[model samples]
Structures are given as C-alpha cells and as structure tokens.
Target: MEILSTPQGDFELSRFPIRSKETLRAWDAADEYLIKVLHEEQLLTSDSNVLILNDSFGALSCSFSATRPVVVSDSFIAYQGLLENLQRNNIDQNNIEFRDSLREYGEVDQPYNLVLLKITKSLAQLEDQLHRIRPHIDKNTRIIASGMVKGIHNSTLQLFESIIGTTTTSLARKKARLIFSQFNPELTPPQNSYPKTYTLESTDYKILNHANVFSRERLDIGTRFLIENLPVSDHYQDIVDLGCGNGIVGLMAASANPAATINFVDESYMAVASAKENFTKAFPDREANFYATDCLKGILPSSCDLILNNPPFHQQNAIGDFIAVQMFKESFIALKPGGELWVIGNRHLGYHVKLKRLFGNCITVASNKKFVILKAIKN
Candidate 1:
C-alpha cells in the first residue's frame, strides 16, 4: 500500500472491508490541496485546537497531526478508515479524539482556533454541524472547508453564511474549492428539529432522519419493496437489521415477530439516531439494540440467527458494491451455524454472485422487474 504523505505524517490508508485491490484511495486531491493551503498559510499552531469535520477517511485529520486535532465525521466507514490509517502508519491513536456525527458537539468545551470542514452533499447537515460548532469559536478562529467543485454551490455558501459568517471560495485546485469563513458573533442557531414524519400506504412509520440521512424524503423504493415482501419467520429468535436506515426492516421484523429481539445497526449516526426514534415511535414498548456501527465490526461472531439487510451500494460520490459485499461477508462471520442472511438489492447489481461467494448458497426469495430479494444461509 502506498503511504499518503501530508503535513501531519505519512500514512497508509484503505477502504473498509479490506479489499486487496480498491479502485479508489481514501485521500483525494481536495485533501492534498487543503493541506497545501494550510501549510502555505501556516494556519495551525501548537496552541491551536482544531476540529476536522466531514473528513472522508481521516485525510485532513491525519495530515494535520502536527497539532493534536479532534476529528468529526458522519460516515462510520470514514471513522474506521481514520483509526485504521492512524494505526497502519503507527500514529498514536490517543493523540486525536474521534467524534461521530450522532453525538452532541457541545461536549468539546475547549474553544477552537481552527476548524477544517469537508463539505457534504446535505447542506442541512452542514448547517447543523456549523451551528453546533458556533459556541466554541471566537472571532479570530479560521474555518476552512473544501470539497470537489461539483459539491460546492450557492446554497453551500449560503449555509456557511447563515451559520458561520460571510464566506468566499478559493480558486479550484484539482477540481476542488475551499470555503473560508470567519466566526459570527451573537448569532442565534436555528432550533434542532428532527424525527420528521412521512405517511405512506406501505407503512405509517415515522422517519427519524437527522441531518445526514439517506433519502431523507419519503420511503426509498428498495426499502418499500423489502418491507412489502418481508419473509415470515416462525422459529428465528435473534434478528439483525443491517444498514437499518430509519429502522424500517427491523421495525417491520419486530412487528411481525413480536417475541423476537432485533438488533438494528448502521454506520451513520444520523441513520442510527433516526432508527432509534422510529423504533421508539413504532415499537414503543419493545426493547432492542440500536447502534451506530461500521457494519458488524463490533458485533460478536456467531451470535445472530437471522440478518436482514438492504446494503448500500455506494459511499459519498462513488458507486460500487464494496460496501454491500463487506456487509454480506461480515454478516456471514457474525451469524450462527445455519443462520440466514436476507438481503434486497437492485437486480442489475448482480448481488447473487456476491452472496454466493460469501455464503456458499444464495436463494432468490422474491423479485420484481427492478429488484431481487435474496436469502443466504451460513454454514
């Protein structure tokens, strides 16, 4: 593996699930440009406490190791990548504190002199993160956020102005632009509103989308199909809803098998938070495990009897089956003997081959013209 050299240090990085040959690297040109600007400007100091947000793979954080930085991001995979990168390069993990998007930001009581922002597609989420960081900034604090040219928009600048202060973009470097902003004093943040409701004939489940959830609108079509055709289980006692966005699959499973305990897992804090809220609203009296995890990373092996997943095929701006493949492979490791893993995916993705490779047997349970639901049993 090639080491990514930055101002912080040189480190090796890889995509999650440990593919032998990944088409993409964790760091990008935008990351390099941001580090270049930071170095050229000498923006950070030993006394400077930095908050790095939306760092896709700890590139910004790892690059800025000169000043012990605190990293915050929405993606659980990003978080995993950061830690693994740090460990791979022999960077002291204790030097940086990693915070996920699910937790409250106010916990960082120390004032921040610098904040490195990485723009996400969700402007609402970016605004919320900025609003939460407001209380910790002083007038002289410098906030530098960057993203690919395609992600920067007028609304992106507007959100920065609303939460931080007036902003301006730098010239594009490697097709990326940086948004520079000053601290805004005496600004009142908008109310933190969440757990949005969406009513549909398929299910009356309330969507608990935080700032950075997937398809925060109505029900996603794949989820709708999975919910409509959920399998009936008579003997399964333990269940897992992998990538349980808004807890739809686990919610439905709970409703069908009232006696079965379900574990809802997703890497996104926003998704898990929303799932928790939906679980509370839908299964008010039921008890279950809801966690913001990187797939089944923290799950004990051979503990689950059944796993239902609508695995994501993409991460950030890239589209691929690496995530889904990892989830299936991980599910196989985490399931008990004879335990079954149920999944739904777009037919064009050819998830059947992936599952067959992992589970040794894959069966098509249901299908439509666009989607196919498959079930694979652990040996």
Candidate 2:
C-alpha cells in the first residue's frame, strides 16, 4: 500500500479487512482534495475542534489528529479501520472520538467548529449526516464536503443548500470536487428522520431501516426471494444471519426455529440497529445477538449450527464478489461441523464455485431466473 502523502502528513494506511493480498491505500483523491482545502484555508489550530463524517478508512481523522476530531460513520468496519490507521500512524488513541451515525452523541462543551465530509453514495444518508450535525453548528463553523467528480451532481449541491445554506463548488482537481457550504442557523433543524420503518405484509411485521442500511425502503428482491425459500429444521439450534440487513433473514429463521438463538451480523451500524429493532418486534421473547462487525472476525469459531446469508456483491459504488467471498469464508469458520450455510445471491455471481472451493461441496437449494439459493455444509 502506498503511504498516504498529504499536506497533513505522510502515513501508511490500509483499508480494513485487507480484502485482498495486495493492500489498497485507505486515502483517495477526494481525501487529498479536502486535505488541500484545509491547508489552503488555514483551518487548523490547537483549539480547532473538527467533525469528520463519511471518512473512508480514516484519512481525514488520521490527517487531522492534532485537532482531536470527532469521527462519524455508518460502517463499523470503517471505524475499526480508522482505529487501526491511527495506531499505525502512532497517533494517540484518544486523539479521535469515534461515533456511529445511528447513535446519539451527548452534549460536549467544545462542539465541532469545523467539518470535513466525504460524500457517500447514499444521498439520503448525506442529508441525514448534515441534519445530524446542524444543531451543533454556529455561524463561525466552516463545512467543506469532498467527493469524486462523478459523485457530485446538481442534487448533491441542492442537498447542501437545503440542509446547510448557500453552497459553492470548487473546480475539479485530480478528478475530485469540493463544496463549501455556509452554516445557516435559519435552516430548520431536522427531526430524527432516519431509521425509517415500513411493514412487511407477507409476515404482517414492520421493519425499521436507518439511512445507510441497504434496501431501506423495503425488502430487497433477493432477500425477499430468500425469505420465501428459507430452510427450516428443528436440528439447528444456533442460527447466524451473515450481513444481516435489518435482520430479516434471521427474523425468518427465528420464526422457523422457535427454540434457536439467532445471531445477526453486519458491517453497517444502522443495519445492525435496525435489525435489532425489527428482531425485537418480530420475536418479543426470542434470544439473539446483533453484531456490527467485519465478517464474523470476533465470533467464536464453529459455535453456530447454521448460518443464513444474503451476501452483498458490492460496497457503495464498487461492485465485486470479494465481499461475498469473504462472507462465505467467514461463514465457513463460524459454522459447526455438519452445520449448513444457506445463501441467496445473484445468478451471475457464481457463488457456488467459491462455496465448493471452501467447503468441498455446494448444492443449489433453489434457483430462479435471476438468483440462486445455495447451501454448503461444513464437514
């Protein structure tokens, strides 16, 4: 991995989970663009309290460690990566305060006076983040957002205008763009408009979704397909829902196995949170564990008797099978001998081959025109 060399400092940063053997640097051009803006504007001082949002792999926080920035993100994996990056850079652990976007941050005497935002793919989430920090901002506060040129658009600028105030963009530099938005106290602060809830008519149950949770509006087609074909058995006592968005898979599994404990794991804090809410609503007297984690990293090996998954083939705008492959690998580690790992994924992703590679066997439980449900058993 290339050492991130910016005006702030030169530090070797690697993304969390090291998805592949060839490590990719955590920082990007947008990170550089924002770092440059902060330097050119001379926004730093010993007392320059800062809030960094949507920071992927902690580039902003690592660069602005001297400011004791508050780091906010929806991805627990990103937060963990940030901590790892800070440790690598020899920054004090206390220099950065990590906050998950879904949780509340209590009152602090010295609120953030500066904000560095990395535009996320989810515009709704971006709006929510801006809304979340609005109340703490003052006239003197400076907010600058950065993203790749391809990500910024008219709607992006409009969101800034509506949430913050008048906004202006900088010329594209190194394929990245920046927006400077003024803090307008007149902009009516938003109510907690996140963790949106909707009803699943099939089960007569309500599902809650936070801003960054995938398929937040409703049950995604793949998961819906999986739910319709969920494997049920009385033999499996502990079930794990890998990448459990809103815990629907686990909810379905729990409904199938009344005596089993369901474990819901996902990288998104909001997803885990929404899953917990939905689980409680779905099964009032059930036992469960909701973990916002990176591919079952801390889960006890071979502890789960069965694992259910709707593996994500992409993260943000980048599409690939790496995430799914890692999930399968993790599921293999977490499942007990003779236990089953059930998953529904796109037909084109060829998950069966990967499962066969890892578990030595893969069986198609079911298949539709666009998706396939596969079950792999641990020997």
Candidate 3:
C-alpha cells in the first residue's frame, strides 16, 4: 500500500487485487490535482452531496469518505478495491453509497452539490454518464473532471460541451489536466445510444453491447478468430466463456454443442448484463449462468470441462499481461482433469508461454498473421 497525502488527510491506498511487487500506485497525478483543487478552492462543503464517477480505485472516494459520497462505477474489481481501501483506512462502510453505471438515478432524492468525474478510455461510457448525471445537476452544480493530458483531446472536450454545458480546462500539472463544465439547465443531451446491437456475421444471433463493453461497435478481430475455431463437442458438458464480453463466443459454442451448458463471466456489470441478454435472446429455452466477478473467484474447483477465453491484456488504463496471467491461473484451477482451456490472443502477447507454465502443456489450435488460437489441457 502507498500513502496518498492530501489536504484533507493522508490515507493509505492500493489498487484492487493487490499484487506482489506492484509498481503502480493506486492514485495518479489527476487524483492528486483534483484533491488539491477541492481543498484549495474550498469547493467541498460539509453539507455537499458529492457524486464521484469512474474512480479507478478508491482514491477519490476514500479521500472524501467523510462526505458520504455516492460512488458510481461499472467494474467489479474497482468496487472491490474501494471496499478494501475503505476498510483498510478504518472508514465507515455505511458512510458511502455505491451504484452501478447501467441504472438510472431516479431514486436520488436531491440534486448533487458537486460531481467529480475521472475521464475514462471509453467515450461512449463518458457520454452515457453525462446524460445520466445531467438530470441530477442544475446550474449551481459544480462539475469537475480530471485526466492525463494525453487522454483529454478535442473530442473529449467537445463531448463535455455538447452534453453538460460550457466546458473549460486548466493548465497541465504533472501531465494531468482538469476540466470544468458549468451545468446548463436549458441544454438537452441527445438520447442515449448505448447497449448497441449488431448481428453476428453469417448468423442470425444478435449481439448486444453496453457503453463500456470492449469492441461494442463490432466483433473484435481476436474474438472473431476464436469463434471460427471453437472446439464444439458433446463431450464437453460444462463450458465457460471467461471474460465473456457480449456472450457471442459462448453463444456460438452453445449453438454447436447443443447438450452442453455454458457459463458467461465478466468483470464489467454492463458486460455481464449485455451477455445475459444476448444469450437469452439467442437461446430462449437453454439454461446458462452469468457472473460479474473477479476472474472466477467463487467458481467451484475442477467444475468446468472446457473454458473459452479471450483474455484482456489490460486493466483500466494500465496495459499489461497481468490480467491474462490471473485468468490463466484461475482457468487451471477451475478445469477438471482432462479438461481443456482454449485461448485466442494477438501473437505478440505470448500467451502460450503462460499457458504452458500453468497447464504443463500447450498446443497451437490455429494461427493467422495477427492472431493465434491455443489450447491447454489440465492433466
């Protein structure tokens, strides 16, 4: 854990699923800048009902835990981090409220006094958030957003202006910038176009994707490659789609293996919801399990006969193979003896090495110039 020194107070913080020899700090320059500005400018009042959006860890929420802020995020891992940090800091769990990003905020009783937004990689998600929070703010509400300078661009600023109101930015400090958007009471944002739908190629299946889901606009090349090479068979009675984005991979596997039951799992609440919807729409009579979890943490040991995965190489903004490593380890434990784990990834990721290390053997199933499909058996 690292100490985040802020004007309010210094708090110990760490990223979710704390790793050994972790090099990344939980809070970033933008988090520090936002905290500094809040205290220096006297933006936060004791009675302020603050709403924090997209706090990667618990940095913002933990720093302002005394305010009893309402925190909104779509990531299960992020939520876990927030809870862990709050408990580690001895903060009262009841002091804060948590909400998922997919739902509307009609149940909120009063307008927010302040809204803190941490810009994300998904522009669609940011747009959807602005539309959702628009009704909860008024002309008096203070809207402040922060991100690394590289992450904020003309398109990002334009999104703010089009959705919230007149938007402005601050001088960069430590490569981090802050955005100030005045809530315009008269402006009506465009209708939310999230949960996009598209038909899978050469199939009648309709795939539904939420705003934050990866490759929501279309089938990502890696996933498309994996789908074309699925090892569908009746012998694999139980199957799992690890990191199942919209359930297309699992849906296709189920289509070919009619007698097998498929399980769809992803960390994103929105992704799981989309997958659940898409799977149900495709097979109304078939039964399946959907989980929004941290990489099969609660799944039964040696329960799955086959696991299909297109492991993500990054977690949030930090890009690495740590997520894929974790998924492989989990797949190893969840697979029964003689069970198989199939993965498709870019050739540069070197997933075969990790799969070999965990499963003791790995074989190439198919390959193209950019992507490779590999299979490992738990023997």
Candidate 4:
C-alpha cells in the first residue's frame, strides 16, 4: 500500500487481492493529475452530483468521497479494491454509490455535474460508456478524462468527440494527459451495438460478447486453439472455466461431457453476463454456475475435478504475469487430488515453468506456432 496525497485527503491505497512485496501502487500518475486539476479549479462542490468511471482502485472515488460520487466499473476486482481502500482509509462507503457498468445510466434521476473517467484499456468499453452516459449529461456537464500518454491515441480522442462532444486535451504532466469533452446536445450519438453475437466456428452454438469482453469481435486465436484441444471426459464431474471469457471453453467442455457441471468464472461482470447468456442460449436445459470473482476465491478447496484457464497476462494497462501467477496458484488449490488443470497461453509466457513449480509436474498437451497448451495434474 502507498499513500496517495490529494487535495481531498491522503489515502493509503493498495490493489485488490493484496500480495506480499507488491510493487504496484493502486493509483497512478493519471489519477493524481486529475485530482490535482479538479482541486485547483474548484470544479466540485458539496452538492455536486459526480460520476466516476473506470476508477481502477478507487483513487478518484475515495478522493472525492465527500461529494458522494457514483463509482462505476465493469471489474469485480476493481470493485473489491475500491471497497478495501475505502475501508482502509476509514471513509464511510455508504456515502458513495457503486454501479456496475452493465447498468444503464438512463436510470439516473439527474444529470451529472461532473464525470471523471480513468481511461480503460478497452476502447469498446469506453465507447459504450460514452453512449450510455450521453443521455445523462447536458452542455453544463464537465467531463474530464485522464490516461497515460501511451494510452491516449487518435482513436481515443475520436471516440470522445464523436460520442460526447468537442474534445480537447491538456499538455502532458508526469507522463499523463487529461481530456476535456463538452457535452454537445446537438449530436445524435450512434446507438450502442454491443453485446455482439457471432457463430462459433465448427459448432452450432453462437457466442455473445459484451463490449468489454476480450475477443468480442471474433474468437481470439489463443482461445480458438484451446477450444480445439479441450479435454473432455466423463470422470471430470465438476469442471471450472477459470477466466472464462464468453464461457466458450466451458460451453465446449459441456458439449463433450454432458454429465459434467460446468462452472464459468471471470472477474469481469460483462464477461460473466455474456457467458451466462451464451451458455443459456446454447443449452437452455442445462444448468451451470457463473461467478464474477477473483480467480477461485470463493470456490471450495479441492472440489474441482478439472480447471480450464486462459490466464490474462495483464491488469488494465500494466502488462505483467502477476495475474497469471495468481490464477495458477489458485487452480492448484481448487483442483481435487489427481484432477487436472489445462492452460493455453502464448509460447513466451513461460507458463509451463510456473505450472510445474505449483503442481510438481507439467506436460504439453498441444502446441501451434503461436500458442502452447499445457496440462498439470494435482497429485
């Protein structure tokens, strides 16, 4: 945990699922830059109705807690992080309202005075959010968004201008930049065409993906490789699709093992929702469990007969193997004795070494030029 000093207050913040010797801070320079600017300009008042988007770790929400801002995000982990940080800072979380990104802003009773967006890695998610929030903002609404220099591109600015209004940017500060967008009531923003559906190749099932879902446009190559090589057996009764994006892996597993009860899990609410919808559409008669949680956090110990994982290599903009490492460790704990954990990842991620270290043995199940599939048995 680190101290994040802002004009509102000094908050000791840490990322969700806090780890020992954690090097990453919960807040970033972009978060600090936005808060500094907001404070200096006196843009907020006690009665101001504020909405904060994609606050990865509650930096903006906690900073402006006094205003009772409505915090919105699609990530379950990020939601947990915000709660954890708010508790750590001894702030009354009851003052703040938390909303899932899937919820429509049309339900809001009043127009927001200010909207602070911490630009996310998914441009689709950003675009969807802009469309959703468009109905709730007027010309007087102040929309300030912040992101790292590398994250803000021409496409990013284009979305703001096209969807919101006339958008501009501030000069870079500490490798972070702020975006200013004025609400243009004249513009009729395009309707959100998200939750897209596509036919799964070689199968009759169609997959539906929310805007923020990974590989929303099509089956990503890595997942496609995993789908082609899924291990299906009658002995695997309780199978889990860890990091189940759109629940395709689990759906395939279910197709093969009709008797097996599939559990679809992912941290993204939108991902889980898409998975549930896709699964229900594919197998209306079948029953499965879905969870939007940190990998296997609430799962029973040694209860799963099989676990399929395509671990994410990064959290938001910061790319690293920390998330994959955690998923591997959790998979080991969640698997029953003699059960198997199957993983497919890029060849360079070195997942075999991690699996061998955790499960004491690892074997290559399949491999292509770009992706490799590894299997580890919990003995």
Each model's C-alpha lDDT?
0.82, 0.85, 0.92, 0.91
lDDT of 1 by residue, 1-379 (tens): 6678876667787756466766788877788889989888988778888888888877777777668887888887788878887778778888788877756553455678898888887777887788778887888889898899998999888877877887898999889988899877866656654435676455676666777776676778998898888766776788999998778788888888888888989888888888888888887888899887878988899999899999887786668887888899899999999899989998998999988988889999999999999999998
**TM-score ranking of the models:** 3, 4, 2, 1
Expressed as tens digits, the lDDT of each residue in 226-286 for candidate 4 is 9899887879999999999899999999998999999999999999999999999989999
Off by over 4 Å in 2: 19-23, 105-110, 189-192, 316-318
Q: Summing lDDT over every window of 10 consecutive residues in candidate 3, give the lowest-scoring window.
A: 101-110
TM-score of every candidate: 0.91, 0.96, 0.98, 0.97
Model 2 Cα displacement at 290 (Å)?
0.9
Q: How many clashing pairs per prediction, in order?
A: 1, 0, 0, 0
- In model 2, where is the ten-residue run with the lowest total lDDT? 103-112
**For model 4, how big is the CA root-mean-square deviation?**
1.2
Stretches > 4 Å off in candidate 1: 7-9, 106-110, 186-195, 199-204
Clashes of 3: 0
Candidate 4 backbone collisions, by pair: none
Candidate 2, lDDT over the whole model? 0.85
True-structure lDDT of candidate 4: 0.91
**Candidate 2 C-alpha lDDT tens digits along 265-370:** 9999988988999999888887799898988888999999998888887664456788888888888888899999998988988889999999999999999999
